[model samples]
Target chain A: MNFSSFPKESVKVEEVIDCIPVGVAVLDTNLRLQAMNRALEAMTGFSREEAIGIDCSHIIRNNLCTQKCPAKQVLENDRAVHLEGNIVNRERQKIPVMIHASVLKDDEGKPLGVIETIEDISLLRELDKKTRITHDFADLVGHSPKMQKLLEILPIISQTDSSVLITGETGTGKDLIASVIHRVSPRAQGPFVKINCGALPETLLESELFGHTRGAFTGAVRDKPGRFQLADGGTLYLTEIGDLPLTLQVKLLTFLDDKEIIPLGGTRSARADVRLIAATHRDLQAMVRQGNFREDLLFRLNVVRLEVPPLRERQGDIRLLMEYFLNKFNRQFQKKIKGFSPEAIEILRQYPYPGNVRELANMVEYATNVCHESIIKQEHLPDYLGGPWDEALRPEVRATVGEMGSYPGLEESIGKRVADNRLNWREMERRMISEALVKSRGNRTKAAKILGWGRSTLWRKMKQHNLV
Target chain B: MSEKLLITIWRDQVAPRFDLTSEVLVATVDSTGEPLHSKTVVLPTVSAEDLCHMILTEGINTVICGGIEEEYFEYLSWKKVKVIDSVIGPYLQALELARVGKLEPGAILREEASQG
Candidate 1:
C-alpha cells in the first residue's frame, strides 16, 4: 500500500508517523537513531531524548541486530527487508515483533535514509498456535462451508474418548473419518482394529470379536484374543454395523455399558479399554423399527454422531477435490496431467456424484492411466460419465448445481420475486427450497436432491422452516 | 570483601543485547574502586538462562549489560543481585563507571568517555 499518499499540504509526515500504534523509526545516513515515534519509545523503554544519537541496533535491541541488521541490509541493498524476531523492551521482556525496513530516497534517487516499522505480533503468534492445535486436521481437504465447519471441529471432538457414530452414504469417506479420529485420539498409540460386521458369518463374527477358547469351536486351533481384547488401550472401528446380528449387538451393548467382554466358551470376562468408533451408510434408526439393530446400542453409539455430507451437498468442493485427486493421481502414474479441460470440468460439475469422492478418485486414476496427453479432455474421462449431460445427470442434480454463475439472473430474479427489499439470506433460502419442492411435485427425496442436501438435513431444515 | 562485577561484552564494546552476548568481562574490584583482578570469559553459546545461572553461581555482586529481558532482571533482583542494564559503548568505560559507583542504566557512553 501507498502510505505516502497522505495530503502533505496540511499534515506533516512525522505527525502522522508518530501517531501510529506501530513503532516507526527513521535512521539517518549513519544508521543512527535520527527520529523515533512515541510507540517506539514505549516499546524500547527509552525516551526519544535518550535514544536520539544511539545506533539503531542498540536502541531497538532486536536479537538479530548485530548479526543481520535489517536497517543496514535495506540501506545496502536499497530494497525492503522483512523479518520476525524477538526484541527485548526496557522492561526486559522479550516481545515477538515483525520488522519491515526500507530505504527512503529523494526524487533524484539519492539514498537518503532508512525507515523501519516494528509491529508487536505476540497476539498473532498466540492465536496462530491455537489454530494450529485445534485444526491439526492434516490430509483432509475440503473448502466448502459444511466440510470446513466439520473439519474445524474434528480435532476438538477427537480429543474426547466418546464413542463416535459416523453416518453417510457409501463412498463418502466414512472410513477415513474413523481413521482420523483414531489417529488423533488420546489412544492413538494403541492398535486400531477394524471389523466389517457384514464381511463375516454371525457365528464366526462373535468369535472374531470375543476371542474363543481352543476347544470352543470345531475349527478353533488355539485360545485366541477377541477384537475387543486385542484393541485394549486403543480404538475399535466397526464398519457396516447395521449388518451386525441382533445377538452381537446385545453383546456390544453389554461391553459399552460395562467395559467387560466374555470370550466364547470362557466363563470369565476381561475388561477392555477400547474407544469405539463405528460407521455405516445404513440408517440404523429405520433398522431399529425393522427389529434388526438394538435400540440400546444405537443410543450408546449416538452419543456423538457425525453426518458426513454427501459430495453433491458440499457445494464448490468438487473442483477442489478434482484438483486434489488429479494432482495425487499425477504423481502415482508418473504423468504430468496439468488439469481437465473446461468442457470436462463443466460436465463433472453438472453431474451429481452418486458414489462421491471414491468414485471421483477412480475416474481420475483411470484417466491418468489412459491419457497420453498432458491435459485430461472429455474422452480421457470414464466412458460412463461422458454421455449426454441431461440424460446422464439427474434433473434434480442439474437444477441445484449451486454455483451462482450457472444461474446468471439469480440475484436479480430473487430481488424481483421478493417484494420486500429487506428480505434476508434465510428468507431467500426458504424461497428456493419451496420452489424446488414445488417443481419436484412435493417429492422430498427429489426435492432434497434438487436442493443438494442429504435427506436427513433437508428434513431437518424443512421442519425448521415449518414446511414439514 | 571486595565487590565483583560482570559486564556482557561484544568485542571491546558492551554487547548490544544480553541474550545474544557470548563474551563477558568479570572484575574483582578492590575498595579503591579499581579491579584487583579481571578476566574475560567466552561462553560456548549465547543463552540468557546460562548467563543468569552463571551470575548466581559465580557470586557476582553486580551485572552490567545492554538490553536484558525483564524476567532475568527480576530474577536476579529477586536474588539480591544489582543489574545495570542497557549500557552501550566501550566495556572499559562502562566498567570504570561501575567502579566509581556512577554507572546508570541506559548510559550510552561514547569513545571520549566523559564522566558526566
Candidate 2:
C-alpha cells in the first residue's frame, strides 16, 4: 500500500475523487489541503488551486475544527473517524454534513495523510422540516390527545356535505377549523366564503347574507349576490352564528331545508348548492332557553358539531404552539430569535390564555418584535402579564377599584372578581396608569418605560384620565 | 447614467449558488461601462430574502450570480433588477466583462486547463 511502490499511472486519483458525488479532500501530514475534488471545491466555494496548501481548518470552518480536528485525530491514531457536524460554506450558509476521515497509510504502516469525505444533508434537513409541518392536520399544529381526536375526525367530517356547527371560545381557532374543513372537503376547488353575523347590524347582515335587488333599500342601487350564491358549489362559513337575528334564522332554516334563497324585493327564489359551516362562541342552548335563539334553526345547524378545546384544556399544546409560532415569526420578520428564557417559558405555561391560540400567537409576535436578544425573556411579555398574577384574567372580570383595598395581596385582589359582572376595563387601566405615574413622581416618560408602554400611550392615558 | 451591479462571490470567484453566497461585490459603473467605485460586503448569514433587501436598499440595478431559485429570481425581476445567473468564472474576470457590459447569463469563463 506504499505510494512509491504503487503504479504511477494506474489510476487518476484526482479524477476518481472528482467523480464521487460527495465532497472529498486529501490533507498532508501537517493537516494542510494537499488536494480537493470538484465536489469539495464546490461545497467550500474554494477552487482546487486555492485550496491546495491551505490549512484544513481554514478551508473547512466547522464547529469541530477549532476544538477537535478529525483529520488530526485520524493521523494520530491511524484509525478512521466519523462525525456528524456542520460547516459554514463560502455562501455563509451553515450546512449539516457527515464527515468520514481515514488515515492514508504506506506499506510500512506509516501514515501519509488523512482523506476526508463530506456528505451534505441539506435535502434531508428540508424533508425533515416538511415532515414536521405535515404531522399536523393541514396547518393546525397540535399533538395533544384532545387535538389528536379532533384531527382524527376532521377527514371524516370533511367527506360529508352536511351542515356543521363549530363551538369554541373566542380566539380558539373556530374560523381556522372551518377553513380547514373546507380545504380538505370535496369542494376544496370551489370558493370558500365567510361572513361574521355579529359584525354588521341586522338589516345590513340580512342583505349581506341573502342577496339584495335594486330598490330593496335606499343604498341598494343594483343587484347583488350574497354569500350563499357566491359560495355556490363550495362552502359558506358563518362566524358568530349566535348573533344571527331570530328573524334571519328563519331564512337560514328555509335555506337549510330547501337549499333556496329569495333575494330582498325579488319574487322568485333561487337554488344555492353550498355547504354550510357555522361557528359561535356563545352558549346557543342557553340562548335557546332564554328565547333569544330559535331551537329549530339550532337543530338544523347542529347536525354535525365540532367542539374546539380551549388552550387551558390542552396545556400540552402550549410549548408546541410556542415553538411553531417562534419558527413562523422568525421566518416572517427575518429575525433569528431562537427560544424563550426558562423564566419566560414558565410564566407562559402558568398563565392561562383567556384569548386561546390567537392570544398565544399574538404573544409570540409581540415578543419577537420587542426582543432584541436571541432569547425572549419575561420582560418582553405584555405589560399586564409582567405582574405577579397567576392567571391572565381579563381586567373587567378582576376586582373593582373599591374591592382592591379589601384584599391585602395583589393576586388575591385581582382573582376575587366574579364573571358576568360589569367593570370598565379602560377605567381600571387608567387607574393603574395613574398609580404608576404617582409612584414614578409624575415623570410620564419614566412611567411609560416602566410600564413597558410607549411615551405616546402614557400621554394619551394621562389625557383620558384628565391628569394632563 | 450610473448603475450599480452586484455579484455574489465565493473565494475570489462567482459563487455557484445565489442563495448560498455570503459575500457580494457591488460596483458602480458610469454610462461608458467603466467602474467608478467598487466594494465588497460580507453578510452575517446566507438568505435570499436578505439578499433581495440588500439589492433594493443599495439600489443595485443588475445582479450576477449562479443557480438562483425561482422565487428570488422572480422577486428581483419584479423589483426591476436585471439578474444574470448561472455564471461560472473567476471573480476578477466576471467583473471585467461586467464592466464592459459583456457578461451574459450562464457565461463560463473558466480556463480550459481547469475543465475536468
Candidate 3:
C-alpha cells in the first residue's frame, strides 16, 4: 500500500531509527556526522552531541573508512552500498559489522545526505567458529564402542612425541587419525610432512625420506630437502610403512636413534628434530614372519599404536556415518536433501562394507549428487548395493548353503535372504568352498585340485572363511 | 618543566587511528609548555611497533593520538610514557592544547562538520 494513498501518520525519524535495533548515522556530503540514533551511540560509544560535528571515520574507526568508503559511494553513484568490515570500539575491542549506506534525497530528486546502518555480527561469527571447531576435528564422527574408546584416548596419545603406528584396513580412516594426532600434538604449529612408501620405488623412496645432495644419482640435478628435513621441528607421517624396503628400514632406525640424516652423496649428517607417525594396512608382524620386513624397525615404530576398526565391525556407526557423509555431500553439491529413505537405510544396513568408511562416504557422495528429490531412495543407491543382489541368491546357492553342516545361523541368514532373493558374494564363496571340502573328503590336496587353485590359496581361503 | 610530545598526524588533522598514521609531529616543549622546536617525521610504513620505537627513541615523554588500543596503551604506560588517546581534529589545536596542559584523553575538537 502506498503511504500517500493510505494515511500520513506522524512518525518521528529519530524514533523510527532508534527502534530498528541497528546503528544509524546520517552524514552530510562532507561525510561528517549530522545526526545519529541511540543505537549508534551504543555501537560506537560516542554520543550524538560529541559526534555530530566530527567525521564518521573518527567515530567508527573502521578499516574501510580510509579506503573507498561506502557513504562516499552512495553520494557519488546515487545507489546503496553494502559491505562487511571490522570497527574498533571505544574500549579498544574490535567488532565485526555489516554496513549498508544509502542516499537520503530531498524533494525533486536532489540528494541531501548519506544514511548508514551498521549491524554487529560478533554473535554470528562466534557460532560459526563453534560449529567448525567441533565438526572439523579431522572429521572423526562416530559413536560405536570401539570408536568411542579411540576418541577418549586420542587426546592423551597426541600429547606425547612418540612414534605412532596406526594400523587399519584400507578406507578405514588411518590417515585421518594421523592428521588428528599431528593437529593436537605439541608440534601442531609445525609442518606435517607425509610420504607414501608404496607410491615410489625403493631408490626414489630412499632419497625422498632423507635429503639428497646434488648429483647423488641420475635426475638428482638439484639439492633437495626430504620429508625428514622438511618435517624439522614437526612430524613426518610415513604411510604404508609396510611397503618400505629393508635397506631404508635400517636407515630409518638410525635416524630415529641419532636424530640425524646423512643425505645421499652427502658426507656430513644434518640434525632433524622430528616426530614420526606411521600408518599401514598390511600386518607388519606377518611380513616379519615371512622375512620380508625388519622386526626391530617394527618395534621402534610401534611405540604408541592406534588400530582403527572397519566399518562393518563398527555396527552402531553405519547410519551415523551415512548421514554425516550425506550432509557433507549436500553442502558440497549445494543441495538441500533431507536423508535416505527407510528402504535405502535397510539395504545399507544389510550390505557389508568391505572397503569400510571410505566406500560408504563415496556411496553417499554419489547418491547425493544424483538424487534430485528431497529424500534419497533405494533406487538412488549404487547398483552394486541394491538390485544386483535381488537376482544373486539363487535356489542352487541356497541348496548348497543348506548342505553345509553345523552352521544353522549362516544357513538361516542365507535362507532368509534367499526368500528375499538377495545375497552377497562372500556367503556364496563360503558355500562353494564347503562343497569342495565335502567332495574331497577332508583331503587338502584334492580340495585344491577340485577348486582349480593352489594348496596355499585353499588354505588361506579356509582360514578367512573359518572352514577349518 | 620542559617536555617532549609526539602527535600522530594525517594532513593537518590528527589521524583517526594511531596504527594507521604514517607521519608524526615531534615537538620539544620549554618550561612554560610552549614548543622550543617542532619537526614532522615521515615513517617508512604504517606499523604500530615502528611508531612505538620512534616514540621511545625520540625521547618523547607524552603522546597525543586518536583511537589507540589497550595493548599499545598499556605498553606505552609500562614504558613510562603518557598516552592521550582518542583525540580527534586538527593537529595544531591538539598541539596548542598540549602546550597549555589542557589536552585530555578522548577529546573531540572538530571545527565544522556540515561542509558539502
Candidates in order, TM-scores: namely 0.46, 0.48, 0.49
* Chain B structural similarity (TM-score) per candidate: 0.93, 0.93, 0.93
Q: What TM-score, to 2 decimals, does candidate 1 have?
A: 0.46
- All candidates: TM-score of chain A: 0.56, 0.58, 0.57
Q: Which candidate comes out best when scored by lDDT?
A: 3
The alpha-carbon RMSD over the true interface for every model, in angstroms, is 3.9, 9.0, 2.6
Per-residue lDDT over A175-201 for candidate 3, one digit per residue giving the tens place of the 0 to 100 score? 988988887777876899999999998
Query: Residue B106 in model 3: shift from native, Å?
Result: 1.2
lDDT values for all models: 0.82, 0.80, 0.83
Worst 10 residues of 2 chain A by lDDT: A397-406
Model 1 C-alpha lDDT per residue in residues B1-116, reported as the tens digit of each score:
69999999986788878889999999999888877999999986577888999999999999999988888888999999999998987899889999999999978895432211
Q: What is the lDDT of residue B8 in candidate 3?
A: 93
Each candidate: fraction of true contacts kept? Answer: 0.68, 0.00, 0.56
User: Which residue pairs collide in model 3, if any?
Assistant: none
TM-score of 3: 0.49
Clash pairs (backbone) in predicted model 2: A91-B20, A91-B22
Query: In candidate 3 chain A, what residue range of length 10 has the lowest lDDT sum?
Result: A1-10
| Ranking of models by TM-score | 3, 2, 1
Docking outcome class, model 1 = acceptable
